[model samples]
Target chain A: MENIIELKNLRKVYRIGEEKVIALDDVSLSIKKGEFCCLLGTSGSGKSTMLNLMAGLEKPTKGTIRIKGQAIEKMSEKKLAKFRQEHLGFVFQSYNLLPMLTALENVSMPLTFKGLSKSVRDKKARDMLKAVGLETHIKHKPSQMSGGQQQRVGIARAFVAMPEIVFADEPTGNLDSRTTKEVMGLITEMARENNQTLVIVTHDLEIAGYADRIVHILDGNIEKIDIINARRVSNEEADNIISGADAVPAGV
Target chain B: MNKRDIIRLAFKNFMRRKTRSILTILGVLIGTSAIVVMLSLGIGMNESFRRQLSSMGSLNVIDVNPWYFIEDGRGGGYSGQNVLDDKAVAKIAAIEGVEAVTPFLQTGLRLVSGKYVMYANIMGVDPNALEAFGYKTAKGRMLTEDDTTALLFGSNTPYDFYNPRARNNYGGGYVYFGGYMGDGVERPEPDVDVLNDKLVLTFDFSYGERRPGGTGGSEGGNKKPKLYKVKGVGILEESQDERAYSIFMNIEYLKKIMKENERAQGSMGPRPGGSQQEGYSQVKVKVTDMNNVQKVQDQIKEMGYGAYSLTDVLKSMQETSATMQAVLGGIGAISLFVAAIGITNTMVMSIYERTREIGVMKVLGCMLGDIRNLFLIEAAIIGFFGGLLGLGFSYGASALLNRFAGGLFGGGYYYGPSQDSIVSLIPAWLALLALGFATLVGIISGFMPARRAMKLSALEAIKTE
Candidate 1:
């Protein structure tokens, strides 16, 4: 498979009142098209920093990042916004849906920035919500929904725009074991069904079990690259795991 | 994002904090109404001054006098250097903005009808220029150039007649009996009907009464002073103008009578003893518009003639009112400036609250310009609605002031052609200008806060609670 995202000698340093702290140092990685990839590490191990640098949310100190052969670092803010609108989707760990909007409105937000008609955006959002098992909570606000349900809506928003690359950062970090298993199943199933590149950053080993490959990080350095599962998870297998018909398994 | 979506999002954001937005808009509403009402009072004062002046005389008419008083060290004497003759009349007419120029000739004569007699001050004007001078008749037609012996009576001219032959004649004094009397009773009409009575004018002031040292018939055997049979052509409409108390006649006919009076008396006329009659003492110049009166008057003065118009009085009055308007407008503007500060504070507070929402939007690919536009539109909406409601309130306030404060000004009664007195006036252009100004203030107030929102770092903003 062709690489969809490439990082060469990536280095990120944070300065807090004159103290220089390295968040990511000399890290190189590649994410293949249609592959489910995970960056796994403990706290302060630079997994979240790697995700931020890759998403173009932060500028690297010294590095080059190419996503689908586009050098986003060289792009202006306006062009980068357009590029993100067309090609990328994000799922925040805290479920950063606007508190004022309902589930349907939240899901349709990304499409609104794309300038789609309200009818088209609403229709797509409705379909994505149904796919995420959130059809019953379409009109529920985040304040009214459970943490797990809000995270499900967040997942729906990430995929509703049909972006080529979806990045999830600890998407189920606030949920319980049972809800975490369901959210992880739903995210992997959606990525596989759409044949999209999925990148997730998490410290939980069980969440990393859903990815085809994992890159382990320690102290701002890549420790190893492990091939977890060569074949993509099938729809039936994902459904069984989410319904608890099959036992939760680890990536061996 | 498209314009519609941006507006929708902006509207939604504004409505999110309903109480805060309403309070901010209320501040703007009070500011706008304050400015409009204050300025309107100044306009109303100027309008009332114009009405009062117009009742006294035409604001567009300039009185051009040939004689100007020159103050020498000894005393002051009238200078007759600039002659207000036919050539000067033509020169003044040729100057820009002078609509009509006519020499005013005036002399006192005795009017007789049967046993009733009155000493009348008859003013002769160009027959063709009567209508242009804004003379309107209530009874008969104005004197035309063809009517040689025509006369136009003043509204009070008939009321001036008294029975000089009566035993208690009060020494031939005028009996006032024309207007509304005290205690709201209508006074009796005059005994003489000037428009229909057979009337004669003579140079004899003692036509029917006893003279101071001789009998009343004629002085020193003068042949009854040549009675000129003049027709009563018109009676002027009753007004507060002093011109309503004077009589009018054709200039040529009056000049012929003056020459006749001189010939009959075997002496010189009212002019200084010159072989030829001296030029008119004063000429009236009518300007096309009241605004042009000052310009025409200045040109006339430059020609060494003393020019005076009601616009002179009006200009002084307007200067005082303009100062009043400035002070009033400044007071109003201070309130609006405070309201602008209120808007800025509200927008700044809202930026703080919506930092996370803005970050999420930017991360979702919302344009930086769109974010700034959203904030600006929110502020402008507040200003527009406030201005609209404030204008409505200003009209209400104006009507209330005019209704209740009528007596202090003109008592809601105007004598000038078609206008009524008002104490507060708001024209259409002022309303529109206030709205535009309020909106501009809103935009200016929102600029800094919008820039702050635009430059907020998306990563840190989303990380904030």
Candidate 2:
């Protein structure tokens, strides 16, 4: 209903040995509050780049990108770090859980960055993992867990802090079709329960089936945008919903 | 993240590579022990010098001797008057920093018992000043003002007595001057028990001289030469001091004996002045503090006496020991420098390996300063533990050195055979300072590596394998 993330004329250019390559063409986009959106593109079409830019992980060459009406691109590194900690979470394509940490530790990492006490962050992370059906695997390290389980931990980490936005890039790119549907369902369900904005970047058409809107990007430019009501379109999808996700409280 | 969490994460990362961490810590250990032991040697030398010099004579005591008819060795090119007599002793006593002043008077006398006679220095001194002069008896009480008839024998004073007839027959190689026979012959034991024997002192220098084969009698031997009955009140411990091979008595009593003996002879004395008019042989000034010894000596010298103290020798000895310590410390510093380089190298290698981990931490909103603090704390912990262990090693080394390292330098590093000789000393301050310095070295060594970690671009670091 309300615009939580706004991008006006976003452009990103990279210099490769004497050639100027445009990684992201002039693109104007806005993500709404509580919307589960998908940025769909081929390998070189800048979907991951878009995710990175929105998460404040990379500086854009030209654009005014604002989150909650504050210009993120213009902020200094120190301020951006604090801003990201308080407002954003990230899930990478490879799951990117620190291999040395257990699943519970990985899930609690976002709350840890927010400087919560260990016990407090741990409790929230445990509840988030239970919501994703990984309660029994809390102490399992990333190397010991399956792809689906690690993505569940990743999803738990991204939402445990109850941030205003979550940027997930190819979150299911390394999982199988069965695991892909399960992870995507867990991620969108958790986001929908909290009414938090979720932005996912992927090349798979099936992954877009769970999104409220699908944005198609071709050659660093948005080709089209499709709005869908997946909840209303499929009653069977509701059965596959994460068991305890809808009970997630919307905390201030 | 909180400070504690950042530090905990850094420590966990350090523990990831156990062997590398241990090796780095070992380097710091060797470096710390090296410096501590090297510095302790200089401190040991200084302490040893103090003990040795003090045993010979109190370092704070100055000797002021009269430059009499014999010119002082100072070679002033123009002779000055010897003013360090009884009057000058009072002047010196009034000088600032002089704790006490005592005059020393020595005259030759013959000690006799039955058939044994010995020529000994009859040292006369004020009984009150004996304690200040550090003179203590090993067997009996020291001479006092009322003990005018008493005498204190030096430990070796009995050795000066011998039969001149037996010595002339012996072939005079070892000088059997202690009433002894030649080789393979039983020497004559002291015929007098000094404490209980009838001790007599005669001021006549030739009292023991006898004609070679003439019935063992000198010119005045038949008359007994007015024997003065004295009591042996004390026997002093043997020392490398002016009192060695001498006998002590009250100064006024010795002067009275000499004056009365000359009156009985009624002959012309050797010098212009009578024995009663003779001045003190030397003056001793005790100082309150060792640091003030040189000052007191200088003032005494300006007053025109040949003055000296142990500080003159101590100053040169300390200088030599300081140079020796510097060279040794330099050698130790080179080792520590190598260790510092090892720390930097280890940190650099750690950074290269943990690039992705650091990137993950940064992306998770850990502050750049926190990342820097983490690495520094890790390096410093290594230094702290190494320093603590190194100090333990140095203490062990010091104990072993003092116990078994004695007698290496002509009996001992001490002046005499002393049990408290120290070859290496690590004072408390040195140990504490070494610990702090080692930690500082670790922090400084980690500085550049930490900066590199802080400057790493999060985006590129995460993209690294």
Candidate 3:
């Protein structure tokens, strides 16, 4: 598969007063087209930082980031915003939908940035909401919707623009186990149907089971890269596969 | 986003905080109306002054007096040869902007008709120049060059004839008290209709009165001055002009009479070999336009003559009004300034409240310039609507002032008794300018807040609550 995203020697550091905190160090990774990849990590494991860096939300201290064969690391802020609108989508952990906007409006926002007319963007957003099973909640504001429902709207927004890559950062962090499975299934299913790349960052093993590959990150470093042959593995199978990969030497 | 969409978003955002936006617009309304009404009062004052002055005389007429001291420009001063003569009249007529010039030959005379006699200050003028001098008659017509003996009566001159013998009688010599009298007393016309009666003029003031030492006849030593039979050609329309009290005549006829009087008195007209310089003591010059009166008067003065025009008075009056306008407009601007501050405050508060929304829009690929334009358009909308409404209010205020504010000045000289006086005026151009100015104020007030919105970082703004 062709690689849609490539990162080499990526480093991120935070300066807190007199100390330098390294959030990410010497991270070399590539995400393939139509690949469902997961960065499984606990708190303070630099998974969120890696996601932000890869999305061009934050500049890295040292690295080169190539998305769809275009170097985006040194791009201007304006150019980066256009690049994000054209090729990238993000589903935040908090499901940051505007409280004043309805589900349809929230979903249509990304298409608005693409300068689509109101009628066209509204129709596209309506179709995306229906696909996410929130067609009946199109006019419902985020404050009026449940946490799981709002997450669905967020997922609808991320895919409505048909971006080349969609990044999900703990998209179901506030949802129950049942809702999490539904949102995760919906996101993976949509990405697979469109052959779009998906990157999920999460601390949950059950969430990692949906990915074709899982990269376990610890202490600002990639501890193991586990390739599962069968997609949508059971939680128990995902744990064994990741534990077996961790047993090998660091370079293997 | 397209411009139309941006404007729509701006309007929506402005309406989001309806109460605040309305209050801000109200402030602008008050400010705009205040300035407009205040400036209108100043304009009204000047208009009234112009009306009053024009009633007194032609504002464009310049009176040129002969200067005795003529500066030869070669150290010779006071030559006394720069009199307002025929040569000077021709020169003045040739000057740019001078429409017409006529020399005045004035003398006191008495008119006798029937038993009534009227003493009149007769002004002799070029027969052809009377119409250009703006003389309008209530009857007959102005003097023409073809008439050898002609007389034009002043509006009030016809009413001034009185019978000296009726002075001691109960119902006696009458003066028209402004064409009004007590109840049932009809306004009396002139006892002697000069236009129809056989009239004779003489330089003698006691022409029709009995002499003290002789019988009432043309006797020796008390002989009546040479009586010239003249016809009253016209009666002037009653006006505020001083000409309403002066009689007009052909200058050549008047000069011939003066010579006849001199001959009848058996006096030599001039010393032999002493040059008899013929000139007029005063000359009247009419300007083509009122605005050009000052320039024409200056040119006349440079020709070694003293010139005065009513435009000087108009200019001084205009200066006073301009000062008044500035002070009034300043007071109005202060309120507008306050309104501007209110707009800025409202925009800043709106920015603070919408910080998260701005960040989201920015992250969604809204241009920085678009965000700035949104706020500016919002502010401008407030100004535009306010200005439009303010102009409407100004018209209402103006109408009210004209209707009920009459005699507010206590009928002072500046506020004359003219029936159509305007107390407050707002010309169309002034209304338009006020609207544009108010809009500009709104744009200026919105500038700083818009810049702050544009400079806000997307990351930080999203992090804000």
Candidate 4:
């Protein structure tokens, strides 16, 4: 497997008026193509910061970050925007689908940036919503949908543009346990079906159980890299686990 | 993103707050109508001037005369120096704004029928340039170049003829002629029909004779007159002008008759006197514009000839009208300025509300230029619709003026040959300019808000609500 994302000595410092706090301290990591990776840490442990850095959402204070051989740390704002539009997709924790837009319109947003005809983008969006099993909720706005359903729309939007990497920043943070399990299953299943790279940031052990590799962080530094070698859970098995059949069966 | 997407997104954004958009558009509407109506008043006044001048003569026609003296204080009474001859006529015709020039070779002649004879003022003109001079005949056709021996009778020309024996009491021009055929009944009409009359014309050298007290004698005991048998080709309608009392004829024919009379008199005519009646009495230069009339007249004056137009009175009237127009326009401009402020307020509020949307668009790969253009197009749409509706309001306002105030200016269509009724006038070009002006105001008012939208930080904007 080839590494599609590389981080070398990455550092980020935030200044709150005067006091400076280190968010990501010399973070170094690599994720292979088509691999599902998880950054697991508690609050203030910089898991979200690391995800943001890899996703080119913020500037790094020092060192280089590359994705698919393209420089992320040094890219200009305009070029980074193009990079994100062409190669990256994001699902925020709050299910950041525009409240004014319906599920299908939200899903087709990235494709709109791609300049596809309205009918073509709508067709693609319809297919993605159907894939997430939200075909009936396609015309419902984010405000009108349930947490699980809105997250499904977010996942659909993330993969609709066919990006190489999808960043999930605590994507199930607002959903219930049952919805969380279902949302995670849909995200990982979509990634595997498309052979796309997925990077999720979360503090949930159940959510981390779905990843192929879990990298743990503490106090802005990588604590350990845990490679999970276990049978992958299908959407049916994830449902069963939520129904009290068994847990994800973590291997230490 | 592509243009369609950007426009679609912008349109959707504009639709998000419908009331605000409608209010802003209404503000622009008020502004546009203000400017249009104010400017229309100015145009109406100008149209009135044109109509008033049209009744007198062409506003484009400037009359040139020889400047007889410098001033009373110095070098005065140097009269009859510059002859307004063929050379000066050519010179005036060569002027830049001069569309055409015709010399007035006026001769006082007597038209004699069998027993009735009348004295008339005969103005010589180039027959080919009659239509250009706006001369319209009421009876027969106007004199053309081929009508070398033709004459056009004025409405008053036939009425001026009287029996020489009966001419004594008809001095005031309203007395009965032909022995009062009957006092309680109608008087005998002129023996010759003006348009079909074959009248003998006798040139008297005292015609256009500038001599002091030179105009006294006509058909008297010590005179020998040269006669030419002439035919009347046309009759002019009555107008509030001197042309109503004058006869017009081909210039070359008048010149020939003048020269023959001079020869017949053998150095006893006005040509041999200090009066110098050999050249044209006056030249009328047709100008291209009423505004350029003064300039062209000044140019002719610089050539040492005196020039005048009704614009001398009209210029004063227009100067006063201009001040009124400016005041009117200023009032309208103040309203438009208030409307522009309203537009700016709306756009600024829009930016503040749409910060998150702008951030989302920026994150979605929309360019900064695209964002700026989107806001501009939104503002322009407001102006576009406002201008369209404002022009509609202006038309209604103008029609109301024409309906209620038509007699204050003109009787709707009583003025000659012009489309304007004069209460409120909006020329096509003024309407176009008002639309463009409203659009520009919208764009300018949107400038600051659009820049602020462009400067918003995308990361912070997204984090904000």
Candidate 5:
């Protein structure tokens, strides 16, 4: 399998008055194509910062980021925008969809910048909405939709352009347990169907369990990489483990 | 972005803010209409003056009169020979821009018809010298060589001259004295048809002989019973003096009458040495071109003559029109300035409201140029519609003014390039120019706001909640 994203000795630092706070320290990681990987960390463990750097939404203090073997950090602002649009998709925990746009319109936005005709974009966005079971609610604005439904629309938006990698930061953070299961299941199924590499950042162990590989971060460093394969745990078992259950199988 | 899309978006945006757009347009309309109305009035005034002056005489015609310079010691009595003669008339006609020249012979005479007698001035003219004298016959016809007995009367001819049967009380009832000849002879029993009929002249050389000069006052005087048949009455269309009435007759007839008088007195030895009429009393010259009237007048003045032309009237009219235009335009400009300020206020408010939208557009890949173009297009649309409305208002206003004030102002009050009315006219070019100027003002007013919108940082704009 080819590597879709690679980070080399990534470091990010912030200054607080007279003291320096390190957001990420000497972090190195790699994710293969079509892999559903999740960075699991508590608060202040540099999980969100890692996702932001990988998405090229912010410049890193020091480090190199390569997506599909092209250096993203070296690109100009204009070129970086194009690169972000073409190679990556983002789903935020708050479901940051544009308020002025309808569900379908929000999903079609990334494609609009791609120079597609209105008809073509509409058709593609509709197809994505149907895939997420949002065909009946395509015309509803984000404010009109429920939290779970809004996340579904966000999922549709992220995958509509068929980008190589999708970065989802706490995809189920704002949802109840049932809605969390629905949104997580939809995201996992869509990523697998499209053979896309999905990188999710979350503090919730149950959300992280949905990924094919879970990387645990402690004190701004990767502490463990657990691959769940063959004998995968059921969602209920993952929930139990996240709720601090005592025992679980090694692969599960 | 493509132009069509930009225009479509601009139109849509304009439609969204209908009230603001209309108010801006109204401002432009008032400015444009005021300019059109004011300029038309200026033009109309000029045209009215021109028509008034033209009716008085040929606007192109110049009048030249003889001027004599007497020696310092010479008393003013006929000190100089008549400078305007046939030779001088011919010379003036040969000048580069001279069109025609005519010499006039004028004298007052009394016509006696039976017991009815009336007095009038007579003008002796060569039939071929009409244009040079700027003569126009308003009634009857001008004299021709074959009609030797023809008499052209002026408009002011006494009523009895045309109606012979009409009663006359000039001398209390009726009294006859016959027509007076230059020599003071009165023939009794004169032809009664001479009131409105032709007279036949008879001359007998041996009828009257010169007596020896003595204190008995018997010096010989010429006498002739020459008659003239009233062929026609002519009305002079133009004259410098309204009260100085005159009539025209063939020069040949006058010469023949003089000769008969000489022969009747038995004083006809050898004919006078010079041509019958030695020189003209006054010569009037017409120039070939109206524009050259002044130049010709100047040349005549240099030749020691008094000259007058309508160019002075036209010049005064031009000056008045220019002054009127400036005053009127200044008034219109004040309104235009207010309209521009209105546009500025509207654009500034629009910029304030659309700041966040502008930022979103920038983030959506709209170039800085595109953002500026969007705002300018909106401003231009406002200016264009305003100008159109202004023109419409001006048209309505001018029409109402003409209808209500036309009579009070008089004819030619509303003079257009091709027609006359009470309301002034707005020409097509001026209307077009007004629209363009309004649009330019809008663009200028929108420029700073558009630049401010463009300079906004996208990140900052997006972060504005």
Candidate 6:
């Protein structure tokens, strides 16, 4: 498998009242094509920052991020926006769909930026919604749908453009356990089917267990990397291990 | 990206806030309506004045009078001098804008019938030269080059006969031409037909032969006398006030009568006193255009003579109209300024409210130009519709004004050949110019807000809670 995303000594710093707080210090990672990798960390452990840097939404303070072998840290804002539109997709934890558009419209948004025809974009968006079991809820707005359904729509949107990489910031942060499993399952299944790399940031061990590999973060540094046989375990057995691991505090 | 999408998005955005859009458009409507109405009224007034002046004479006529030296610091006598000669008349005619010149010579004469003698002023005009100066014939034919020996009667003269006791009988017997042809008592209807009537004039000129008392002699002894036949009747439609009391005769006929009288008296040689009778009292020159009347008048004045033109009246009318238009335009501009402010406010508010939407579009790969164009198109749409509605309102208002003015003044106040009942008189070019100007105003008013919208940071906008 080819690496779709590569981070080299990535560092992010925030100035808080004249003090440089290192959000991510000397972080390095690689995400292979079609690989589901989760960045598991407690709050403020720089997980979201890492996701944002890989998604080309923010520039790294020091070091470089390459998406499909193209360095994004040196890219201009205009080029970055084009790069994001063409090669990167994002699902925010809050399910940040435009309130003005329906689930179908939200799914078609990235394709719109791709300059596709309306008919083609709409048809692709409809097909993605059907793949996510949301054909009946196509016209429902984000405010009208549940958190899990909205995340499902977000997942459909992220993959509708068939981008090389999909970066999700805590995909199941606002869902109940049942809905979390359902949404995470949908994201994993769709990303795998489309041969798209999925990079997820989450504090929930259950959500991290859904990824083939998980990288643990502590205080802006990678603490450990854990590989799970996600394809070998039944979904029920995977849920038991995920819920059993939740008994421990996230960082321990 | 394409025009269709841009227009569709702009339309959708505008339709989302209907009340605000309508109010903004209304502001523009008031501005455009004011401009249209003011300009229409100005045009109407100009046409009215032009029509009135045209009716007065050849808008091209210029009257020339003799210039005299002051005796006691006041212009007294003519000083027995002929300032404008036949050569000067010819020279004036040769001027670029001069169409014709008629040397007006007037002399007091007694017109006598049997017992009905009326004292009249005789004005001499060249029979061939009157037509170019806006003279029209209402009854008989106009004077011709060959008809130099006849007189032309004015239309306003009364010529009727009636019996004394039949005045109340309506239809009665009357005597015609000294013959008693009557049924009971007849009064002839007032003669509106006085074309080609004869008028006889008798005048006296003094040279060296004066009476023992040193006064000019009467027509009886050693005095000049003349008579001319009636040939043409001219209707002075424009100058009835000036021509009503006078009669027109061929200039050559008057010259021939003078010559014959001088020859019959055997005074062909130079007179003992050396006075010449070849000078005109006044000369009225007609120019080729009303616009050139003032220039020609000035040229004439440069020859050390006094001249006047209708331009003085025209100037005063133009000044009054300019003042009126300035006042009207000021009011209109003030309203337009208020409307512009309203547009600015609406745009600013829209920018503030749509910050997140702007961010979304930016992220969706909409260029900065596209965003600005969208706002400009929205503003232009408001201006376009406003201008259209304003034009309609101006049309209606001008029509009502024309009708009211016509009713009060006993004739249409607006002057034009058509005299259209609805005088919303904006010329086509002016309407186009108004619409264009309004659109420009809309664009300019939208500039600041569009810039602000363009400057919005996508990160801040999208991250805003």
Predict model 5's lDDT versus the native. Answer: 0.69
TM-score versus the correct structure, for each prediction: 0.88, 0.78, 0.81, 0.84, 0.56, 0.69
Interface RMSD of candidate 4?
Answer: 2.3
Docking class for model 2 is acceptable
Residue-level lDDT tens digits of model 4 in A1-252? 567998889899999998999988888887878888899999889887787788676889998898999888788877877888888888878777776678999999888877788999999999999999999988897889888888899889999999999998888888899999899989988999988999999999899989977889998999987766323322233334446534556454
Q: Write the per-residue lDDT of candidate 6 for residues B5-56, one digit (tens) a residue.
A: 5666567667667899898989988998888788777766665666566545
Q: Which one is best on lDDT?
A: 1
Inter-residue clash pairs, candidate 2: B162-B179
Question: iRMS of each prediction in angstroms?
Answer: 1.4, 1.8, 2.3, 2.3, 4.6, 3.0
Candidate closest to the true structure, highest TM-score: 1
lDDT, candidate 5, B179-251, per-residue tens: 2212345434323333245422223322122234532213345443444435454555534332125666776
Q: TM-score, chain A, per candidate?
A: 0.91, 0.89, 0.90, 0.90, 0.90, 0.88
Segments of candidate 2 deviating more than 4 angstroms: A1-3, A100-141, A160-162, A192-195, A229-252, B1-7, B33-51, B65-82, B85-118, B122-136, B142-154, B158-202, B206-233, B246-306, B385-431
TM-score, candidate number 2: 0.78
Error of 3 at B184 (Å): 15
lDDT of 1 by residue, A49-109 (tens): 8887777777789989999898867778888778788898888888889887889989999
* lDDT, residue A102, model 3: 80
Candidate achieving the largest DockQ: 1
- Single out the weakest 10-residue window by summed lDDT for candidate 1 chain B: B410-419
Clashing pairs in 6: B172-B185, B172-B186, B173-B185, B173-B186, B174-B186
lDDT of 3 by residue, B281-398 (tens): 7899999999899889888878988888778998998999899999999999999899899899999999998887777677666667778998999888888888888889989998
lDDT by residue for model 4 (B62-91), tens: 988875444557666454457777888898
- Model 6 residue B32 CA deviation (Å) reads 4.2
User: What lDDT, from 0 to 1, does candidate 4 have?
Assistant: 0.78
Candidates 4 and 5 compared by TM-score, better number: 4
Give Cα distance to truth, residue A185, candidate 5, Å.
12
